[model samples]
Target: MVHTQEYESLLPTKNTKHSHRRRSFIIIILVTIAILLGTTLGLAYGFIYWKSRCIKTHKHVQLKHVLPGSFGIEFKLHTKNTSDTSTENDITIKWEHEPKDIRYRQKTEEMVSNDSVLTTVTIVNNNATVSYELGNETCWLNPDNSSIFEWYSILPLIMESVRSNHREDGCRERMWTTTYNGRRVFICIIDQRISYIRYDNRVAQSQEWMVPSQSSIKLPSDATKCGMMDSEMTSLLVVDDDKRQNTSDSTRQQLSYSQTYRKDNEYLKQPEIFVRSAKPDCLFIHGIGVKSPKTGYKSLKSMSYWGHIEKNTPQCSSHKFIQFNTVDNGWDSVSLHKMFCEFATGSNVDGRISNKIIFTHSMGNNIVAAALHRKVCSFDVQSSKWFSVSAPWRGSKVVLKLEDLCSGHLGPSHHKSENLLWLVLEHTKYCTHEGKMSPAYRTLHPTYKSPTGISYDDLVAVARLHVTGALCGTSPWGMGLSLSFSGTLKFIQSFSHLDQPNDGVVALNSCNVFGKKFQSIAKFALMSVNHLESSMKFGCRKPLCSWYQIL
Candidate 1:
């Protein structure tokens, strides 16, 4: 009996051990699951937060601040809806007066699509409240839903017209127009920049314009003064007209293929081997990505067309190439405008104002267009011709991709082990994004329709010619990424949204604008030449010298 009792006790102890083991195993699995779930949720939250921050940062607007004083301001609102259905009543305007101490008078007039709804508002008291608003589903102002209360002392324009019978003496008035969302808007200023804005002749909602002035009020004449300052004391090198004509006549005949240089000429001492003309008639403007001397590349001299132009176009052999500091400072449209203004107004080598034939590549086209839009170039009587090659009239979508990649929104899947590699990739992408968002890109973006007064037809009036290359083959390396199995896969994945043929850099569809009103002189299907090669002849080991034949 004693032996049986002892054995039974041992059996119970063994059973207890088995139960303990099973419970431990269950606890470990639950803990592991909880850890995994926490990690996933954390990553998801981080991604969402980052995305929201990006959107908010991009949406925020920067407004200018103007002082509070007795001023006359006019509001001109224009709206357009491309939908078949009209959005006439969908638009609304609101205004506010601050401190409730100022008397306001307003007048509103409605006009056609191209016309503006003129509103003249007058402020009677100093330190008055002024604010303006526009409401519509689709249309807004240049800065978008922004009120000028901060920038100008005017509440909104509420007067009938400065030319009306109730005009005040010494009330200076000026008008400026801007186009936004298919709408043309005009703002007029009178004695004091104070105007009341209302929707459909309704009373404007008033708010106190109490913000402290950051700067003095800017008058219309200030703009004219600035323009004059830009043109003041400028130097120009002019080519003699008689010499220019002789150069043109002498080189009118095309050079035979045999006359072209295929290999390095031992007898040639300088990089420029072409024959020189007595005078230059054409101006050569290089495209974006043109490196400066600081970058170890001679801006214009490095270009494949540099040599070709000298060799082929006798009119350009002796011309001074316009070497813009594009690589270092970026191709800023405003700067280009000033440069063109100087060029157009400044005298040539012979101290005479002369018409020019412009040849541009890539983003150089944007500079040409901007100069024309700003009227910097006198298009009257003078026959100004423009030749654009690989013009990204609609901008490149690759910029958006590069921006995303730099922002870490797109990249190789992240792993703890590859964190260092990921950082390097991110840095490279950021540099590329910063390097490429030139002013030219901003102007070329699809959303940035040409300047208010400019059109393709207007450009064509200057006799524009466009050349684009298509049928580009797959690049071994694209935008600094290898095209191995994994790299190519990533390349495709990154640019999967692009559907048209690209010259390694720019899509064929985005290369030129085509319409009933717009057409290219010729389209070449160069299977091997990519975007850079289209304008950059020496881009490849065996340079595509043949491509320059079109010039």
Candidate 2:
């Protein structure tokens, strides 16, 4: 109905293609604006959400940072006040940078589990400190042998962040911004002396990052300037920060647990070197009661002595004899197992395999047996002949006597005796009336019943023989040689007379493993020899050496 300007007609031809192109361009512009607006709004909403949640109080809690190592990877702990309204039993503090769906996460899953807030959580005291260490999950090592790596070359970036915050005087200062538990607690250096950061962060959020403001500062401004040696000296002064009281059953239960294995460089000395490349003729294991250093020394000496012996053997004319330490008698059973695992399997220490030999021994033979039952490492017991010399297949009477002398301070024999007595009383009080004893205790004959089917009868028999021999001074190396042999004969006779098949000292019926299994599973034979039967007489050897015959 209105008059159009002449320029409108001249501007473009009114073709359908031109109209369609114009409409498409407009739609694209609208979509682009919508996307930009949505992105901006979402970012704003997220920032607000994070700020709102950042300062919220965890119920009945005060905050503290007890993290070890650098200030950057600060470890935090909080104390929580318990109330009837709270359902959780334990409180744990952990670090997380992103949601679980993130592609890379290096911390232990238990440290970050969402369900950590369950009813099993233990209540922490007002001054408890939480601790954690950061390690590289990506580092690889060859299990067969030691890998060469510079010990200090691999510090993490998180440690670097904390290093920047270290105070003078070698103390690490940790400060707090929020009331995490109930108190506004902070973590300072455990020891200002040896304060090289122990905790490290493996992941990086970005190529360039700013330090977080919330982390506490490390104290003693001079702490960061010391050399590596000085750092260790400073660290010696710092005590452990974990002070969670024994409030929960689980925490209390951990009292009996072993500490994690930490290697002591001073303890690692060169092992006894056997220069020979050939297989050893025989390996000997001596009994317990060794001087600590002598245990290592004798282990090495065994190789040296065996090498000399092998040179004289008929089998080797030119080949050298080599020996390796198997089970050293000095270590306790626990220490023995741990050492074997580290050296044999390279579970912790970078160890190598170098020795294989026919086995022989005294008390240590039994330890070898115990190690086999435990299957502690990659040790192979089935490949060699095991010749046991004066083996204690049963509980040792000597072990009990030595223990009684010490009033139960040392040795396996004492522990076993105590356990036996405890089991006996428990069975008498709880089981005899109902005839419903736990199979384990009943099988052990805990109540010390009559001689028939009574398990302790074997223990008693061994003890009695031990006491008899003690009066005569007649053990294997005792002063009375003839009486000792007679006692040995008596011990053997008792075993044969038992209605139950026994190991002459321990019972064979129970199938309880002996201490000789380190060599027992191998092909072995026993023989007696004495030093006097040397030098050929008309190319004929003595028919019987009296000392050897007595043996």
Candidate 3:
């Protein structure tokens, strides 16, 4: 009995040891899991912080913020109006690199009845001093949200045109002038080379506006001028009450033609020999200012088309070209189409040649779109090629906004036309007429009807005058978004619906051709290139001399 009892005690001891071992195993597993969980949580938090920092940096880059040391150092000046004359001696600008000597200049001038003051800063390094004009109207504009501010800022070229000639005897175009924040201002942007009229009171001289460097910023192409004009200037007729009265007196003519045309009226073309060799066959249209040709040439070599309309031939030698002219900006597409079909589409004076490829630019593009939609041309759709460059198929947004403010004094069609005649008409109506643009439309229709028997290659060269200064106000994607989006969406909503290729400013998918997505094809593409680059490749820069000399 004693032996059996001892054996039982040993068995119990063994069981107790086994239980302790089991408990240790479970505890080890729990500790391992806890450590892993803590590590995972720490890693997740670190990743979140890293991602947030990256996003912040990207945002800054988009906003054009130069990273510290990117431009060597951050430099800026804070300007404030001062009335405490005694503080002038206390004013000290602690610049990182101080100017050798700094001097301030001020001028006061009267405008109509009010006096305006302009201030400038001059910095001298030894005897060489750089004079900087600060208070010029454009430079000193109150920097406000008013249209007067935005318009003058974006359309400097247009404003320059009005200022230089609008008040002269040759030019009597009415213009809108308004005072903003106690200062008078106008909206125009002409080339920097052109001279402008001085303000009635010469408080400040016009300063050379600063254009942004391409490495840091990209500006719109049309913000500056391009191309050249004819040496033998064509005259334009101006009719006004004063001229009318003078003409009725039987001593002076009712209207006299001036020997100059707006820079927009000019053209550049290739040599006659080069044109004829490319495609003895092409079609051409004439716009309002274009005169009727006496006869058609047998080939592009003998082509007598206005030099300006065919100036692009050097770059487009691979394809045949045609030209069409509209009667100024006022002629409707229907009328222009009819004239093209009857006068331009047929053979020359002897009527022996065949109709060829159709092409147009500016107002001519508008006519072509109208013509194809109306089935005015009866060519094979597959074989025919249609193209246009810098065509503002959709109207300008600025014009529509101005019309809204003027209470029906400008129409959608006024700014809607991108060509010279259209702009002139729109300006005259809003500046002189009394129409309005309501229900702002931006961008051309994304899904437009392709003209029967015509494959359209539409190209848009965006202008800075319309894009800058109002990012939030104007649509980001140029003109008509809804019209473009819905039209494009409708055209490309299904692959089963398309029949050809299409190209928008840079996005292939925006075009509606060949029943595919905007950019589904290898052969068909939509792309965007810098306007200056395009001008260089095509030799669009004027004076030909500038092409070689200026560079």
Candidate 4:
């Protein structure tokens, strides 16, 4: 009885027990508050670190982690690898990924392609020339755009996979087990520093966190000058991942010649901004009937031509323009091609020219097309792009309309529009080659000898020259005509001589479509614009859907 009473008293009184409970509850609340405060502080520190940290402490590359699990690759090629045999401008891209088609099973278990280096890229006259297995299939990139040859292109998927795995041991180990160009990669992180990016996957599979810095990283020396920002990188990730997930496997295989790279749906949602551009050294060639006080590429006089195209009209950041005057020579398209080859060959300040972007308006397209088809000009077809505006691929009937008006078929009584007099005067006076219409004007005729020396009736055969990036034609900004007065479209639309959809001077069929009718085409392909505005800048506003922007 005595032992039991002693033990019970020692246990506690009601007030004492209440006081002890209160103390315990206070301690628990304090501990929780401290933990939450610490967590908030840790997150803040992490955010700051992510915003400003280098891929290496030496700032070899800048990786700005803008979103959680979102990745970016900012190339900073400040150091020249004197130890390397390759030039500083050379960027050898080593890439590999999973097999495009699972059905195309590998002979070995590796599922790797036979080639390891996807491409060896070099800057030749400011254009990125890619030397790879698929040589001609590759397009030229502006050397200032470095997204393709960066490590972070493949990082988003790896980061997303790791982010999803809640049970990961915090080592943040990721392995691309499948082969890309005969190489499997292992990417791992230690002490929150990314390390161990090698084609061999053994170390990552083993989960050894102690990975030394990879010495094989090399980028083009001009990488630091690239224009694509972090938001663009995020957008690229979103678009690529979306296409990969949504498209059927068979469809994907059919769309691609070689699966250079691809991503799965596991990637986090990317931001809604993306851009790609090619602002190479541009050679602008003007169309027929270029009048006096001739606004060369320097004058910026004709918005109808590419005047102020790089800024006010078709905006791009870095493009070097060389304007060629249409009236500089009196030759036809065939003669112009030969003359152009000689001029282009000798015009090189550096004594060599390849991969120069050609910007043509009207008849210039045909002349350049002939030169390219005949291999007369030495433009690197594998890296060059041809952007033709107001291209009369099928030949316009409006030239006939002008010829009739000039020949007095439409008498002075019939022609009340003074624009008719202006056309006849300009075409005859400024653009005269013979007693009649100039050779440039004749080249615009549907039945004339084409620049290619082929019958213009076989328009498809003449229009079949291919470049790596061929940008063709532009839609007329629906407004007042460049040559004539108001209601000109209505006049041309009503004219017996002009029966088709005409852009005042060039018919729509001639400028863009060459008789192959489809129910749907890209919106950029659709013609005509602006019913309300009377602006005479009737050429295309911009090539918004160009491969430089949309692709």
What TM-score do all the candidates reach, one by one?
Answer: 0.35, 0.24, 0.28, 0.39
Model 1 C-alpha lDDT per residue in residues 300-385, reported as the tens digit of each score: 33233343444444444344466654544333355555664455446212222244555666667666665655555544323333
Off by more than 4 A, model 4: 1-279, 291-304, 312-335, 342-353, 408-415, 419-436, 450-452, 457-462, 467-477, 480-486, 489-493, 512-524, 529-551
What are the RMSDs of all candidates, in order? Answer: 29.4, 27.7, 23.9, 25.4
Prediction 1 global C-alpha lDDT:
0.36
The TM-score, computed over Cα atoms with residue i paired to residue i, of candidate 2 is 0.24
Order the candidates by TM-score, highest first: 4, 1, 3, 2
Q: Cα lDDT of all candidates, in order?
A: 0.36, 0.26, 0.27, 0.36
Task: Please say which candidate is ahead in lDDT: 2 or 4.
Answer: 4
Which 10 consecutive residues of model 2 have the lowest summed lDDT? 141-150
Instruction: Answer with 3 or 4, whichever has the higher TM-score.
Output: 4
lDDT of 4: 0.36
In every candidate, how many clashes are there?
37, 42, 55, 3
Q: Which segments of model 2 are wrong by more than 4 Å?
A: 1-278, 294-298, 303-332, 340-355, 358-360, 372-375, 380-387, 397-551
In terms of TM-score, how similar is model 4 to the real structure? 0.39
Query: Tens digit of lDDT per residue, candidate 2, span 116-176?
Result: 1111111111111111111210111001001101011121222122222334343445422
Candidates 1 and 4 compared: the better one by TM-score is 4
Which candidate order results from sorting by lDDT in descending order? 4, 1, 3, 2
Q: Evaluated with TM-score, which candidate comes out highest?
A: 4
